[model samples]
Each structure stands twice: as structure tokens, then as C-alpha cells.
Target: MYQRRTAVRRRKSRLPSYAFVLAVVSFMLAFAFPPEQPDEPSARTLPVRSLSAAACSVPPPVSQGAEPSIPSSDGEDGWMLTLVNPWNPLPEDYACTLTRLSSGHSVDERCYPDLQAMMDACRAAGLKPVICSSYRSREKQEELFQNKVNRLIAQGYSQERAKAEAAKSVALPGTSEHQLGLAVDIVDLSNQNLDSTQETTAVQQWLMAHSWEYGFILRYPNDKSDLTGIIYEPWHYRYVGKDAAAEIYRQGLCLEEYLEQTA
Candidate 1:
């Protein structure tokens, strides 16, 4: 009877040992091979989040005495941010008070002072900044565009090809910024060609670097032709006011992009 009782006790003790061994092994296995964890989000997602946040954030108000808020087309201050492009044509009857340059090219009266100042500054720096072209009526713009297209066709291009190629240099009629009276085509007086080579002239170089100080920007920069939908025209400049010009310069943004971003 005693032997039977001892055997039972020994068996019970062995069961506890087996249970403890299994518990220990399970604990060790958990540490050795843990459950898989999900991957963290990628860094590429940061910009999207930031952009989303920025989209929802309100832009700070312009300071007192700073350039006035950009206005709609009907407002007196509308011309400052007016956009003219193939996709955005000028309205019929769109007009501005114009002041004529010595070259007989006219610009918006509001921008005349800055234009004169820019030219005077250029002269003071021993550079001759000639105003080759400025504001144009729709008729004049049509004539210019047609002339360019005709010349391209004469060069053996098809009518469709000529129109497309000509448009890179001459905006179609109402789409021209010149019609807005805020654009100017300037060239070195000594080198009076509106070609890509104009960018190498001292006057052109100076204007590109400093025109923003006078509210002008290289309207069709070589790098931004894709965005501007125009060929690189180093001789062309546009007046967008000091504040807008400064921001555009700082951001390295084309006028179209700037207007879009601000809008």
C-alpha cells in the first residue's frame, strides 16, 4: 500500500516538472521568434502630408502699406495680377491707361514710372536698354503672329507646324501679355536682335539679375519655357509690382505658377 502511494506522489511530481519545462520552452520560443510587426510608413509620404497641411492652412494677411491684395479683373488693381496666356485670353474691351516710351512703345501708365526707372538705372550703369516692343492692340498682335507663322511656313513647315512653331515666339492675338500693357521686350541698343543670343549681352544680363528690384521679371526664362508655354525670350520682361516680383524671384517661380499658387 505504501509503495502504491509513493508511486502516485512521484507521478504527480513528474507531471508538474513536465508542465514547468513546457512553460519555460514556450517563454524561450517567444523571445527567439517574435510575431511579425507591420512596417512603418515610408518617408515619401511626408511631403504629401505636409502639402495637405499647407493646403488647409491660411496664408498670412498682407501687412499694412504692403502691396494691396490681388483683385479680380473688374477692380482697379486687377491688372497687377492679370494673367494672359493661350488658355486665358484677354477680355474684349480690356483697356488700360498707357504711357508711351521714347521708342513709341506704350506700357500701362501704372508701370511706366518703374519702366523709366529701370531704363534710367540701366543707362546709369553704362548699359543701353532699348525698348523694342511693349503693349500691342489685338490687330497688331494678330499681324505679328500671322507674320511669324507665314515666315515659318515659307521655311517649308506645314501650316499646322508653322502655327505651332510661331506660337512659341508670338502669342496668339488676345493671349499676348503685351495686350495687357504690362509686358516689355527690351534689348541691348547695340545688339538689337530678339534672338536667344541676346541673353549674353551686358544689358540683358543686368536686367535679368536686377529687374525684379524694379518690379520686372524675365517673363519667359529659358528654364521655365515648359511652364510659360512660350519660347525662352531673354529680351522680354513683365511688370508684376515689387512685392509680387520679389516673391516670384525668391521662389524661382514663373508668373503663371505664382498666380496659381497664390490663388
Candidate 2:
């Protein structure tokens, strides 16, 4: 009986150690293989949704110091947003009512008032802005292109090379935005040169910063020439109506990109 009781005591003494080992083993197993978590949406998915929303949202109209309200898409004025480039040429019969400016340049009648207002504002700020070029008939554009090509050829470039070189600065007839009457080339009165260097002047800087307020945008910004299919032209501005201009300015997009994104 005493031996049996001693055996029972020994078994009781080992019980706590066995329980402890079992608990340790369970913890090690849990550490090795954890429970599966429920799948959740990833963070990367948010931007796509946000981008979709942005793409669909209508651009807000400009406020305070903004130009006139943009017309409805059904109106003739809607042509303000038309895209003209080497790839997208103007229609053969396209035309608009022309209004002559005091500068001897002409623009679409619809845009003339805004153009005058913008120039007036510049003059108020002591900047002498000059309109260097504006509306061009198809024949005029052809002449300009041929003149540039001839000049390049006279400089000893091959015919093919001359055409290519001239096209870099002057668009081929139907592709020239000047034919649209909504585009204008402006220069400081003291320096009428149209070059990339014009971007450095205070007048040009002012136009770049404030043109959107008057329903205008820089047509070929220095960084957007590749997309515009033209060289960087700091002096060129296009009237795209207030809302579109503001949106284009806000996004820093060329007209082609703006059209593509909205389309």
C-alpha cells in the first residue's frame, strides 16, 4: 500500500510538467502557422478610383477676375476648344467672322473682345504687348510654309531636309492653328521677335500666369512641343473659353492632352 501511494504521488508530481509542455507546444504551433486573415481592398486601388472620378468630373468655371462664361457645347462658340495639329487638320471649309484689331491683326469676332481686354490689362500693368500675328487664310499659311521652306533650301539644305526643317517652325497649310482665328501671336512691343527667349520677359511671364483669366492659354509651352507637334512658342496663345482655359492651366496640359483626357 505505501509503494502504491508513493507511485500515485509521483504521477501527481509529473502532471504539472506535462501540462506545461503541452501548453508550450501549442504556442509554438500557433507561431509557426497563424490563422488566415480576411481579404481587404489594397491601397493601390484608391488612385484608380480617384482618377476615374477626376476624369468624369466637369471642370469648374473660373471665378473672380475670370473671363465671360463658357458657352454650351451645342453653340457655335464651342469651336473654342477645337484641336488643330499636324495630325488633326482644320476642315477645308472651316471659317469664322473676322474682326480687325488696332494692331492690324485680325481674330475671330467672338474672341476679339477678350483679346482686347487682355491687351488692355497688360498695358495697365505697364507692359506694351503687341499682336504680331493672328488669323491666316489657307493661302497665307501656304505662302508662309513655302517661304520658310525656300529659306531653308537657300541655306543649302536638301529639298527633303528643307521641308522637314520648315515644318518644325511653320505648320503645313491646313494644320496651321492660325487659320482657326482663335490663335494669336503676341510679342513685347520693344522686342517683336518670336522665339523661346520671349518666355523670359516680364510681359510673357504675365501672359503665362494671367492668360487663363481672359480665356486664353499658351498653345505650345516649352515642355509640351512634343505633344503639340510644333516648336515651343511662348508668343502664341489660343482662346479656349474660360472654363476650358482654366482647366488646361490648372492641369498644365497642352490642348491635345486636354482634348484626349476629356474625350
Candidate 3:
């Protein structure tokens, strides 16, 4: 009985010594080699992915005052070349006086006269051009974008996938040119649908051929979606001033390409 007790005590005493030795080794190892810490990113080098969803909606803040006007090689109003897209976002302070059309849709007051002239010319040509969509506020743009995302989600796309697909059709809030009051979606009065079929209408044919004359261009042309980051929207016309519009049409260049070449 005594032998058994002595053996158990010895085992218990050895355990404490073993634990103390293990702790000392651990301390020594820790002191000899400190853990390596990850390097922190500089403020300027911070990734966009780290931003919140709301921050991601609009692009990184670009100083409105600091924005350089695109060079006007042909004396086009450089301001007319303000580029807004998935990568380039509309400045937060962007403000324009809206002029409501007879159809109740509003557009930038700066482009109203040219837009009216274009519509009159189209009518004179016996083509019925109808302004179906014009300037959309950020709220309206968000609603349209969310509706598209929801539709894609209903079709079994994951949330992230749905948002990406939706962006191709409906521009996210500040990324849409419509928010600048410089873009209008015109359709045929007889067939008022926003789709590829609209491109076949007489109104689209007339506008496609002559919109540049009125300081507007077919904003999204066929096969240029890779550059525009949006689908071919034949009816969407953007007012880039007559000279720039004419140059864009002549070069068969989308706004992005035109800006890059001009820049």
C-alpha cells in the first residue's frame, strides 16, 4: 500500500516538473523568435474592396473642382465630355437645372434646346421620336437597379452575381449617365419598348444617322459593350455638344475611346 502511494506521488511531482520545463521552453522560443505581423496598407494604397456597400455604390470621391475638362481639340465644350460609367462615377456635387419637356420628362436645361430641335427634326422627317426616359435622380436610379438585381436573383443568381448582371442593364445610382441629366432614352412613338427591337424602328434609324448633328450620340453602340460596360442601348443618346458628337460619330468611337484618344 505504501509503495503504491509513493509511486503515485512521484508521478504527480514529475508532472509539475515536466509542465514547468515545458513552460520555460515555450517562453524561451517565443522570446527568441517574435511572430511576424502583416504590414498595414497605406491610405492611398487601400483597396476598393475594403469599402462598404454604400461606399462601393459610388466610386471613390473625386474632387468636383479638381476634375479636368477634356481637351477641346475642335472647340467642343469640354464640360460636355464629362464621363460617367462603372469606373468613372458622377461627382457628388454635380448639379444641373432640369427642364421638363412637354412629355413631362425632364432633362438638363443646358441640353433642352438641342433636344427639342432634334425631336422637331425627327418629326419633320416623318419619324416619331419619343422621349421615354430622361434625367433620373439617384433614388430613381437605385430603384431601377435594385429591381433588375431582384429579377436576376429570382432567376436563381446569387446576390453578388445578380448585382453584377444587373449593372450591365441598369446602371448603379451614381454610375448612370442619366443622373447627369445629359442622357435620354428615346423610342418610337408607335412601338415604345426598350430593347434591341427598338433599334429596328424608324425613329432609331433617323436618330442613329443624325443625332450627332444635334450634339448627341448613340451612347451605347452594338459590339461596344466591352468598352462601355453596358449593353447596346440604341435609344440612349448623350449630349456631348455638337463638335464632340460629330467627331465621335466620324471616328465610330464610343465615348470611352474618344475620351482616351482625346485625353
Candidate 4:
């Protein structure tokens, strides 16, 4: 009987030891590690994977002139804006008002006059002036031009035709509006969804009501594609200075229309 009692006690002690071993094994397996641990804790897990070394990052969006998921925040994406005068593309030597580039996205430099005034006015109106795209270098244009050409070729266009089509969509080195340093691509300040539809923002109404006051004119319009040799672009606004903005708004003229009358 003593021997039998001794055996029961031994079995009970073994149960606790077995349970402790199982708990230790569970902890190691749960952590994907061995039983032995390093004195130091493992490095913290990082979930973000960045493609570049830039300190700042911009979200990925399709190239410009391509429709945003937002369905454009304005008419024809805001091409209905008034063109005050013929924006004789300003001289190249003009200094920019302020410049900010977007990293990991296509946005480059923010040019002066219009962007500066627009930003100030937006702030004053309690709006945020979000830059969509700014200045693109000649090299950048070439890259875009080449990409368009490639896409056209893939779509069965011959080299010459692809070149021609690309020309309409992609500006040559000196001909780009960006070269003038007065254009900016901005998003509506009130609502900030990357993919929000135009109906979701009031920028269109605000711009229509006040864009001319800031010396800005939507550079291209649905009514003037033939003259510009490009499709209507609503987000692009040119800074023609206040006088031109006034005349354009007053006469209900686009840049093309104003140019025709003056010419």
C-alpha cells in the first residue's frame, strides 16, 4: 500500500511537469521561434514597403490627362472656366513664386503667379490647395511622349501615326505649358478623397465663381480642342494675370476664342 501511494504522488508531480513543458513549447511555436531565446528582443516588424529613398511619399495615381476616379471635380473636369486672354506663354526666365515637388508620384515643381495666388486664395477661403501635378521637365515630357508612342504602337498604330498622336497629347521640349511656369494641377480642398467623384467636392463651383479673380483661366476647353490640338483639360489653369482673367470672364471667352478675336 505504501508503494502504491508513492506511485500516485509521483504520477501527480509528473502531470504538472508535463503541463509546464507543453506551455513552454506552445510559447515557442506561437512566436515562430525555438525554445531558447536571444537576450535581446527581435527587431520590430515594419509593414510599410517603400520603393524609394525620398523622405516624403505621394500616393500612386495614373498619369495626368487620364481621367481620375473622381470623375473630375469640375465641368469637363472644369474646362468650362473662362479664359481671359491669349496667354502668350510667358518667357522662360521668369522666376517661380513657390515650388514644391511630389515624391513617388509625377508632381514636380509648383510654378508661380497663378499657383501662388490660387494657394493664397484657397487658404483665405478656407480651402486646401492640393497639388496634383506641377512642372515637368523636358526630359519628363520626352518620357511621357515615348510612353504614349509605345502605347499607340501596341494598339496597332504605325510609327508615324503614333508619333502624331503622341504629339497632340505630349508636348515637345519647349512647347509645354509647364515651360511657362504658370500652370498647376490642384484638387478641391474641402473633401480630400483620392478617388472621390466630382459631385463630392465644391472646387468646381468655387472656381467658376472666383477663378478669374486670381488671374487664372482654364487653358483648354471642350469648345476649343481644334485650336489647342488637344482634348479639353479641366484641371489645367493658366495664369494670364488679372487683366486677362477679367476680360476672359467678362466676354465669356476661352483662350482660343480670345485669340481668334484678337488675331
Quote each prediction's TM-score. 0.71, 0.71, 0.72, 0.52
Clashing pairs in 2: none
Over the stretch 125-221, how does candidate 3's per-residue lDDT look in tens digits?
A: 9888889899998889989999999999999999999998899889988889998788999999888988999999999999999999999999999
What's the best-to-worst order under lDDT?
A: 3, 2, 1, 4
CA-lDDT, candidates in order: 0.74, 0.74, 0.76, 0.51
The residue-by-residue lDDT of candidate 4 on 174-247, one tens digit each, is: 44665444565556756544332532356755665677887777666656655554556655667655655777
lDDT of model 3, residue 106: 93
CA deviation > 4 Å runs, candidate 2: 1-77
**Total clashes in model 2, counting residue pairs 3 or more apart in sequence or in different chains:** 0
Please give the lDDT score at residue 110 for candidate 4.
29
Highest-lDDT candidate: 3
Superposed by TM-score, candidate 4 places the C-alpha of residue 1 at a distance from the truth, in angstroms, of: 99
**Candidate 4 or 3, higher TM-score:** 3
What's the residue-level lDDT of 203 in candidate 3?
95
- Model 4 stretches astray by more than 4 angstroms: 1-114, 123-128, 189-201
Cα misplacement distance, residue 210 of candidate 4 (Å): 1.7
Clashing residue pairs found in predicted model 4: 74-78, 75-78, 84-248
Per-residue lDDT of candidate 1, residues 141-244 (tens digit): 99999999999999999999999888878898877989888999999988999898999999999998899999898888888776577888999899988777
